[model samples]
Target: MPEPPPLTNHGKTMTSVFSLLGRNENDLTAALGWTLRSSPKFLAALTGALSPAPQARTTRIDLEVSDQLGRTDLELHGADHAIVIEAKRGWLLPTVTQLETYASRCGSAPIAHLVTLSDCSPDWAQMHLPAIVGEVKVTHLPWSVVGERLASARRTSAGHERLWLDQLDIYLKEALRVVEVNNAEAYCVVISNDRPGGGGPHTYREIVEQGYYYYPYGWGRGWPAIPPNFLAFRWEGYVQRVHRVLDYEVIPSLQDRWPDIPVLSESSGDRARSDVTDRPHVLCRLGPALRMDPLPTGINYRANRLWVLLDQLYTAPTLQAAQRESQVLRGDAVADESASI
Candidate 1:
């Protein structure tokens, strides 16, 4: 991976700090947040759409299909998605060289679409993208439309995207075990910089003091099964309550617990708006945090699909087939082979 672009400018302007917020992450949450209640196609494709967003916190594959002649922009592992973007930017446009490199990296993954934020020839994107991404639906929105400028890859002081894959593999193992709609562990959001009210983390600690999350008694996605004994954070003027506060030991940083990244509060100018909240905030008390601004209600987080699947599977009359299928499906039997059945 190429080194991350240095924060350009003499480090002036809110753009240096707030520009990340403006970067078009291709985030489904944010995109839908902007487009939903209007575009039904986007609404239907919400989950997958957001999956490719930069800050999903979901770790993915990395490949930069460089030309035999030269290396260019990076290509994250992207297949089985509906869109592919050849938005090959920076010093490598106006030719098939960059596109070929990216397409090479695309090896074997089903291509659904391609989009390019770069000012490549329309003929190039329109004609070549489908072939390059192979079946991924292709659309090249201008960088102005996609909202990405200033290109480069993530880097650490160690240089390069220096994450330990071995650690990530273990993290995924633990995450898979707890990612189900049922039996999910609680998530913690940091408040290190907040000017807390009486509620905040103290409320969560109080809930923990009362044993709210004790041994499978709690639920996520909605309000805490127990109330009045919960904690709430005060932002602006709204009081956002915790569903189940926990003393968790997530192997990765606490940031990974929530399925999404927290967007910045337009009202507050903090470096980050808030933590990716564990469960959606319960409206146990509402006056303290910003009220007019509502929170998201996502059923995917420990509320919707998996438990329903389990309930029906467990109750099916043909117990043998369901059990066998469950074993194959859940026991790490090959995903492709298992899906065929």
Candidate 2:
């Protein structure tokens, strides 16, 4: 249990809530970046083709194959130079025998691997592998930190905190598991939170100006000043409308009208479309002291929206608008921030 926040404002995480705990590596891996679904073929292809660069730039190969017996749990294609993976959140540790079986079939020169949602000590795995597969690598990914980060973001953003929470619940309860093996160095890369002209007049414009990857709905890379991904709008509802054209500003009126409105989710879709479903939307803004203070109840309210309100909205206009407002001026707000709307 975390202690109540200190009045002195150190702004540190309440260490009690983050003490030593058992972990699942696969979940964390998926939470950090990708979610592998569909078939073993898809997981393998995603790993085989994922680009090492910050900007993704590669066409992935498909490694699904069928055997005379039935659908092969894993597949590899020789010409494509790819590997396939099959997942079972059930096992304590995944085995190399699984990898060798796929390698033997594909006859590809590239190294093949196995991924699992659960894991054991590497020593336990070494104890079980047979000669034919002993050398084949088996990557055991745990979902601990990745899940925690995604969950925390969902529960804390100002814009769509509720929706993000909902989306997060879906992720937690689902049968989903992913394996993100990279030839490139892998890290959970969140952009530097300090962006100029961040929090805008209509949204969390001020905080976004500083460096804090956060916002109402979990949009964009959220630099605390503004949203991470785009200007605040989702397909189902107006994200930042004043409380009531009849009365309040978009943020407050939205709450007055529909207290049940959902928060946002920070996750994205395969197409990289900005309008991913269940991303957050606004409910209401909070007082300044509450807004900046870590572990504030309202912070969770906003974080909920980022991922929950991942619905698609028109991207072109919003992108255009964000650019016009933030470019080339030493604004009371950040310059070059207009490109973000």
Candidate 3:
């Protein structure tokens, strides 16, 4: 097997106070609270992202408020509006009960909203979290979106505010595992395709012919938070072909994004495809398919998907070798390798 490429830092590097303070959920909540308290413009931008428009004025910002129901991560009270924010470190989804309890506190305000900030995508939240708990409207704002809003607000800011925004942006990306920008150190996702034992709408022929691959978009689904730069098709007990990801789209259905492609479902059994066909999917348009040496399947591989460093995928002789190389690159121990993927 050929040697793997050397790992190098690709994106902008910056120092963040949050990074020094042990970046966790509490730190994230505190940083967000501070940002809101320090900058009214940022607060307005955040409020605008939520439904029912921006609040007139933010009267108070509180962190880690404990009550009979549960401890709310952060709370923002404004004239006629109350916004409760629950911050999770990574892709952790907020429980319905926890959200409902937070919603209970918002009853006093004329306009109430519950927002959840996490690395999980909006589509995942929509599929998992309830839209409304009682009267208060529920919204899941991905940290990526929050970072974008803050960056936008920072462009017009100056001095300490702009500096803080820059730090916060870096912190959010590093700490919260927000959408990863494509770079030289990009990875490839190896996806399972339909076969005799595996049942799905996407057969090997369909994917090769269509010039695209898709994964169901939701929490616990195999889709990556950010689309990988490359995709490897794992079928027939080996990785048959690899393709560069030209572009991607998240859509409710195949026809919704590509009207020409017929909506397809499994021909046998329960027709499981029907259950997911109407739901959101991440469709990745591919560049020319590149056939590779058949990388043999390995035991302990992830059920439907696995992540491999692009260089490793190209050079490693076996699936397990690629996974091991990726694990080393990610600094994950043998036991924790699967968990990280």
Candidate 4:
């Protein structure tokens, strides 16, 4: 667990809860430059990507070296190579003319990289820039890719540098909605039915009609860790069939407004607790559902938890697959509906 920050920096309420990236785009870029300058391995990786080169030596590493002409966001200069970076945050896309302006001023630099949080590359960025900029090979980087690099660097960093990199990593993870899972790549998660034989809140029929699903996180059960971006729904005691998969976001019930999702009350002998929302509930915007035909036999009901790996479940290519599976499951559920007339 993270230690609570000093509540008051000299008898005042702490205003900037987040560090560099949270403040603004300029700060994020500047921080990146600072981090790269401190780490020789990262600096070499950035330079090598632009063009072929030998191993970069830390002795020659230079950050923000004399960009008086272009005023680029960052400049990593070395003895025989250099890279000029124009960093962007959020949806701010650089135009062809703007890139051209920067490239022109780079003065025969080995690489001119236009990095942004998203893919804002129009045709001209890829097709026209290389020809116009001459020797400067142009490239685009999404925050996701950059976040991967930061994560790698963090592992080898030390002391204050590692702390700063960790802060930047936090910002990237939040913005990118990527989760670190099972010592593997940062990926999404899937929710498994607590009861292996099905019969749970938000059934297949319900999920198909609703377009979204919500499950309270950490409800004192052995729930698996939730991923950063998406969620998948799986039925236990069955052949790895994924009924639905959707991109999801976490909503803090205490601090943030609840999502406007349909609430259905389906409890036995009591008023349903639909309206009493919980904090850190995952709301998955429903997507494709897949079914496993000819259900495998000899399956055992084990865990009473819902955390599942997203890739392990099977996803159907079409709604027909979901419909076909739902019909079968719904029939079984109806037969088991003891309250029916």
**What C-alpha lDDT do the candidate models reach, one value each?**
0.31, 0.32, 0.72, 0.45
In model 1, the number of clashes is 23
Q: Could you tell me the C-alpha RMSD of candidate 1 in Å?
A: 23.7
In candidate 3, what are the lDDT values of residues 103-126, reduced to their tens digit?
A: 887867877889999877798689
Residue 191 CA error for candidate 2 (Å)?
A: 53
Q: Estimate each model's TM-score.
A: 0.24, 0.27, 0.67, 0.44
- Would you give me the overall lDDT of model 2? 0.32
Candidate with maximal TM-score: 3
| TM-score of candidate 4 relative to the true fold | 0.44
lDDT by residue (1-341, candidate 1, tens digit) is: 99666665446332222233332222222222333223323323322333333323212322233456554232333334323244333212334444444444445554333445443335434644453333233445543232221111112112221222222222222322223334322221212233222123434334333333221112233323332222322222222233423222211222232223242222434432223233223322212221223222221121111111232232334322333455555564433212211
lDDT of 3 at 206: 74
User: Which regions of candidate 2 are displaced past 4 Å?
Assistant: 1-58, 61-64, 69-81, 92-98, 119-123, 130-135, 143-169, 173-341
Pairing residues by index, what is the TM-score of model 2?
Answer: 0.27
Span of 10 residues, lowest total lDDT, candidate 4 = 332-341
Per-residue lDDT over 18-97 for candidate 4, one digit per residue giving the tens place of the 0 to 100 score: 44234455666666776676666565555554434534453332334344444556655554445556666442356556
Worst 10 residues of 2 by lDDT: 241-250
The residue pairs that clash in candidate 3, if any, are: none
Off by over 4 Å in 1: 1-14, 18-69, 78-93, 112-114, 119-138, 147-341
| 2 or 3, greater by TM-score | 3
Supply the global lDDT for candidate 1.
0.31
Best-first order by lDDT: 3, 4, 2, 1
Question: What's each prediction's clash count?
Answer: 23, 106, 0, 2
Report the number of the highest-lDDT candidate.
Answer: 3
